[model samples]
Target: MIAPAPGISLGIDIGGTFTDLVLHDPALRRSGSLKILTTHADPVQGILEGTRRLLGEASVEPGEITRVVHATTLFTNALIERKGALTALITTAGFRDILKIGRERRYELFDLMLRPPAPLMPDALRLEVPERVKADGTVVTPLDLAALDAAADQAVAAGAEAIAILFLHSDLHPAHEEQAARRIAARHPGLSVTASHAIVREMREYERGCTASANAYVAPMAGRYLARLGAELAAMGIAGPLLLTLSNGGMTHVEEAIRAPVQLLESGPAAGALAAAYLAGAQEPRILAFDMGGTTAKLSVVEHGEPEVVFGFEAARQARFIEGSGLPIRISTVDLMEIGAGGGSIARRDAIGLLKVGPDSAGSEPGPACYGRGGLEATVTDANLLLGYLDPSRFAGGRLPLDRRAAQAAMARLAAALGITAEAAAWGIHDVVTEAMASAARTHLAERGRDASGFTLVCTGGGGPVHGYHLARKLGIRRVIVPPEAGVASALGLLTAPPRVDRVATLGRRLLAWRAAELEAAFAALEAEARGVLARGGWAEDAPAPERVVDARCVGQGAHMPVTLPPAPWPTDDAALHAMITEAFTAAYQERFRRPPPAVPIDLVHARIVLRGAARPLALPPARRGWEGPATAHQRQILSGGCSAMADIYSRPGLMPGFSARGPALVEESGSTLVIGGKGRFSVLENGNILVELDA
Candidate 1:
């Protein structure tokens, strides 16, 4: 085993609102975390500033850092803002309009003017190639190399830094696409190319093409950003291997990430779900991971210690919560239901005076009105501050002080417009936003056959802990687990993720095939391909074999579910293979529909495998070693509908295992502050996780 170099490792997660950084020293078992307002104009500035501030606080030299793991929403933001490099698209002849002709479905049927997402590549940049492939992995016509070369020249002349090639049925037969790419690369020399078959070999033409196009859209941006971030870190004397978190809730080397940033689009939310799944620690646990940031709130369900894995996701939607109104990307992402309810969400009265929370946010540049950052909009944070939920003086650990006057002015305008008091207006906004989140959580859970009561709430992100208690109350959840470093939870999760690579290919085979031996050979080939990728990513030759997987469905079903198979020498016998496939399909179906499907002829749609390296076990901070800190004096606060009562403020670091602090208390850590309202109880678990149980 290669020992991690002797130095502090920094994990940075750049979110829409804040850039979180965590510095840990394995040898000393010490760590520190920081949260800085994101500098959107130049994100690298925030990274460098945060890194310098954190290292200064720890009195550690940058040269002592051995590794850096990072995750960011930059690529997603670029796609959303259409700020990526000018790119071109090449497709099979007569398919130039494929992107424009999305699977035409309106998410909102009643809307008069619904707009499907515009393609990343413009019509002028979309060129067609002369090639054709049958659905069953057969090339009907050779790729027109001369035509491809001509298109390449056009794309280059048009200033396309990146190019996406997506041909029909390429997932079944990638040889044509591969040959076209090699020839184009040899000619263009500098253009970045992404082939649908190489990135995602799924059967859907639109989805596969969309995924590869999105990857190309963000390739140049991600490459430059990562290169700059790495150089900045090294200049500061840090000598560490830098890794990036992927949407699949795993880490990959930085070099791999720059080439395929589409995989990291959901990286932030995935990390939060990982943290929840790992720390929830309940038997067959059902968890609602609520991560609220400045721009949006993410809700993901976790069951049996793993977050649900989704094969495809949409981004940059015209409607934040609408599914089909965005760019579809084929990548494995932790299934999350995200909405525009966040601290920076601007609150307003709609046409009929009905309170509306948001689909718009006051990002870090000119944050909420309370931030006194030139934002005149009344936001959720302004409302929270007006309602006395946040300490205006202590916001962001006092790095950015809040302006009560600004908050009051913003709220007063809304109050006057609604004919209500400022406090009442603030209360209304807060409750409405909470209801929005709770309702979203409930809908996501019910759709998945999950109950809120069956799960523990693990809330993180900048706004998570602040809003968690109220959300729990609304959901009738009694237990809420707020980790010590709650605000930076996503970045912390990066430190624990194992290096993994997920690969997929379409087989389109029938389960009642002519030979079971053939199925075994197919599985073996897929597994070998996965191991090869893991090896290329620096895994040792003797590393454990990868997890084998397949996407299966009934013969006539239009879609399928992914199922994992036991390591190699896969069930080769006919009856055994059938049983294995049945068990997997049944379990997955049961989880979704609450019952097994009736026995029917099933088919295999796709074969997949994920090679995961042995995860380095994390050293959890010791549970507050037997709890005696300074004597705590009780302070008073108003109860639900009653008179004021006393509560204590305890220092979490001073608390030990078996020690407990009860309600109306404040637990302050360097990274974040946790407020335990009246009638709440807090405990330090053996793993150093703080469990807060609130009165329902």
Candidate 2:
């Protein structure tokens, strides 16, 4: 067994509104955490400030930190805000329109004015060179190196800071794309070069091209930010390697992350899902991991102790719920749904005078009016304050006090506009946002062919616990689990993620025609590449055997289903291996479509391998020795179900395992609050997590 490193391991997650930090001391079995508003202009500023505060409060020295895992939405924000570096794309001749053409499918068919997301690179910057590689890995038209070099020079002269090289069928034969990348990098030493094959080996030229372009677009900015963050940490006397959490719920070295920033698009939300899986999966395998932060609410599913993962996702959509309206990124990501209905989500009357909760957020700069951060608009946070769900004196652990008057004043405007009382308006805002989240969750689960009734809702983030009970009731979920350190759950997730690398290669071939030796070789090659990546990320020892998955589809079908195969050292007999693959595909197809297709030929579309290293077990502070009595810290009047009532307010720290309370009640912790509606019951679990069960 490899001995674990000594000292503290820090996990930092920068969200849309707050930068959360968690410092765990394995030796002492203790953890300290903090949350600070994110600095919009410079995110690192918030990170640095939060880091300093956490360490100081914990009385730990910088040198005591052995490792730091960081996750952020900065790259995603860059893509959404269009603040990334100037970038260009170079592809095979005649494929310059691939980005623009983009599958040519309308996400919304009935809408006459449906608009697709704009390509990262404009037509003028999407230069193409003569290069073509056949689907069978044969070079049809050799790459025009001189022409590529000239085009690269011209792109650089045109102020392209990064260039994405994507040749036709590069997934089948990457030599041309790789050579063009080399030529561009050699000619322009400082320019960032992204080859599609390096980012994704899957087929589908348009998605691959989009992923490569997005990577190149964010590479320069991500690199600069990471470099600056590393230097800053080093200057603070912490010398540990800085790791980054990926959208796929794994940790990789900063170097690897900077090279493919597209993988970091869902980094922050992925961590929250990981945390949910880690903390609640043992008790409930099927869990709805709901995280409501300051700016957004994300819902992911965890089944059988693992979060659901998807091969590709769309980002920065013009229409939030529409699939094809955003940029397609072909990278493995935790499958989740995000909606802008967080605490900082702006709430106001729409043009028709109907109250509307966000898809727009005030964020941290001028957060909710209750935050007293210069924001005049009412938000979910302000509404919560007006409803007495949030205590003005104890918000955010009292690091930032809530202004009750400001909150009331802000909501009063909306109330006046609606001809309702401020409290009534606050309830409307709260109900709208909660319903929005529940609706999104329902849609997400329905799309996966799952129902929310049987799954437990594990809530995290600043607003998650506060709203968990109501959301659970709406979703027909009886139980909701709010883990310890829920407000900083994403940061805690960063600590729980194992070092993993997922790699895939396009392998378009009929199952019956495949050679055992060739198939084995392909799997072996992918495993080797994944292992190399894990080694570079400092997890060389004790890496587990790679898990293999095949993307298979019936011949002539455009879509494919991922089928997990048995562990490696595949059968040597061709018939046995073929049968094994066929059975798995048939079973998966039956499960999804209710029955297997009539006897038909199946083809392997992509071969995937995931290499995972054993994650270090995190030792949370042990639960209190014994349960005390009711332990009511105080009593407060709270509005619930349109009725005002005096509720027992309990301090979370004072409650021990087996301690139970009945609602209406407020369980107060430093960074978060758990609200239990009328007839609801909450109990502290063995792991110090709060499990709230709502009455039917």
Model 2, residue 290: distance off in Å is 0.6
Candidate 2 per-residue C-alpha lDDT over 33-135 given as tens digits, one digit per residue, 9 for 90 to 100: 9989999888887888888888999999999898899999999989988989899988888888889988889989899998888988767899988888788
Candidate 1, after superposition: displacement of residue 662 in Å? Answer: 4.6
lDDT of 1 by residue, 34-106 (tens): 8889999999999999999999998989878877888888888898889988889999999998888988888
Residue 71 lDDT in candidate 1: 85
Top-TM-score structure, candidate number: 2
Decoy 1 TM-score against native: 0.93
Candidate 1: list runs displaced more than 4 Å: 1-7, 282-284, 541-543, 595-599, 623-651, 654-662
Error of 1 at 141 (Å): 2.8
The per-model lDDT (C-alpha) reads 0.80, 0.90
Assess candidate 2 and give its TM-score to the true structure: 0.98
